[model samples]
Target: MSDQPANLREQALEEAALWFASLQDEQVSEQERQAWQKWLAESVWHREAWAKVEQIDREFHQLPTQRSFQALQSAGRSRRQFLYGLAGAAVALPFAWHQRDILQAAWTPGTLHQTAVGERRQLALADGSQLWLNTNTLITVDERAARRQLFLLHGELYLQSAPETQALRINTDYGSVDMMNTELNIRLGNNSAHLAVTTGEARVQLAQDTTPVTVAKKESLAFNQTRSVLTEGISANDEAWRKGYLVAENMRLEDFLKALGRYHSQGWLKCSDAVANLRLIGHYPIADTRKVLDTLAQSLPVKVRHITPWFTLIEDNRNISHS
Candidate 1:
């Protein structure tokens, strides 16, 4: 009775692992499919654990060799096998042999890296690529000679991918995108992924579908989890967030706040409905969201209120008499 929570957590993680494995199996049933989807959207902890499993799945799919891929596929835990590893070793030996030793050698524990109430971090990858982890970001990378991949599990990342021997790809929960000599960035919301290409050309292919659409430089695309339709837009400052600032020229207040919230750990930035239509044209820093918020409040006809450590509300302040 005392260990039920721990058991449930472990069970939840195992269920996530099974979900990914089932994706690679052709005979997966509709019930199993719906079950996995339900678990994913069940709770924050469930989603986090599922993300860790997907992180590993992306790594497995991006490996340079088939042996590594097979190993990962075999190491996948089953509800029965996880609980009876010792007893099932004999029964699972043949499958394990086919899986290879990649899983054992490259087992990476899951970790959640997040920004504090107001913090940001610049990350440098081993391949010389750079990542600007947005506030409250939880990302994981699986780099290999044959493939370069990133899982923008939540939040956002300003990615400046370095040249690679092979193609580079960024896999999200919804789909996978491929890049070529380009600077691409991704922002993950509830069930959507917004992608912007700052420089060079690239292509994005939805996972459920095969054909990919080419995106020229300075193009942006948005993808919803359940829909294959991609919404397209244009932004000159596609990579501006990487420069520690977001440049907006006559952007709407609501849109600007949405972008600003990406760099905030508190993840709450709301513009009053009264001032939502206000036009904003300025540069907001990504490194320090507080500075940006302060600058906006002082420069605009609004009052910034800290509702909580991580939540902020911007409202109209029209009480200044003609004194």
Candidate 2:
């Protein structure tokens, strides 16, 4: 999960699964075997994926089928998709949800890191710390700068700072964070910023403020260009994208979709006014946005409709929806 392109890794994993399937087809041909060998020679990632499939197969065989099934029946994932090939015998393509997006900037020259929509990246810092850049994010890090500094140009990130190292300096368009040892998430949006502290403490200062506000563990702060508000009720799952899930706990359908929308760069995700306030609760996988949508339709009284490749509409399914 070090800065490799997630999409490429996913491609390798899916292809590995298909190759495994074809090889097990009983009618497997010599050409198929040759192609598999050729594919394995292509890259280390490909071989790693192939090895993962073999290891998972061994683990599955070692466990009781019912016991294994009981342990892994979360979120109703198809057997074909097992959180990056935990089910080796599955034939359908599975996503590499653990895959991390690539990084162009190692805080070297230029020092800019960006991830495409739906892509996520993890970076190890110079000070034995780490950070994760969320979807459609861009940031700048000055690795050579003493005490270390990072700028969130846009999008979101989670940082785990080393307690023994110098305090990290995290800058945003609207504010800045200074912390010695802390685990936190920072999100930047249009005229808005959000901070959630999971461990330790962070001292944040708005651009115009002379003094910094201290945010402690389990606390969060939300602000605009100027005004800011703090809260403690933010759930730990607020940052679940790192685990490749969009968790909803008795949340409004509208709000859930909006959060889910971040994982996609498509046109839009909309619900009719009639279902806007409906409640939904679940852990939705994000590797395939369409699967998440399909899951939503199964649990909620809603219909999923495709308007265009870029647009999706969620409508009431119980009756002809007018709203």
Top TM-score prediction, candidate number: 2
Error of 1 at 73 (Å): 34
lDDT of each residue in 25-142, candidate 2, tens digit only: 4555677788889988989988988888677656645756543432232111321234254324332221112111123234333377877667889998877898999877778888
**Residue 45's C-alpha lDDT in candidate 1?**
60
lDDT of prediction 2: 0.70
lDDT tens readout by residue for model 1, 1-323: 23447667666665554455444445546776777777678776677667665554454346455444233233322233332322224224525633333243234323334443235578877778877875555565777535766666556777777775356777776788887667777776555787877778778777666667677676777876445444456564556655667898998887888766655644246665667788888777777778888988888888776643323667666631111
- For residue 20, model 2's alpha carbon misses the true position, in angstroms, by 45
TM-score attained by model 2: 0.65
Model 1 segments more than 4 A misplaced:
1-118, 225-233, 307-311, 319-323
Q: State which candidate has the highest lDDT.
A: 2
Candidate 1 residue pairs in clash (backbone atoms < 3 Å):
71-99
Candidate 2, pairs of clashing residues: 267-310
What CA RMSD would candidate 1 show?
Answer: 17.6
Residue 35: error of model 1 in Å? 47
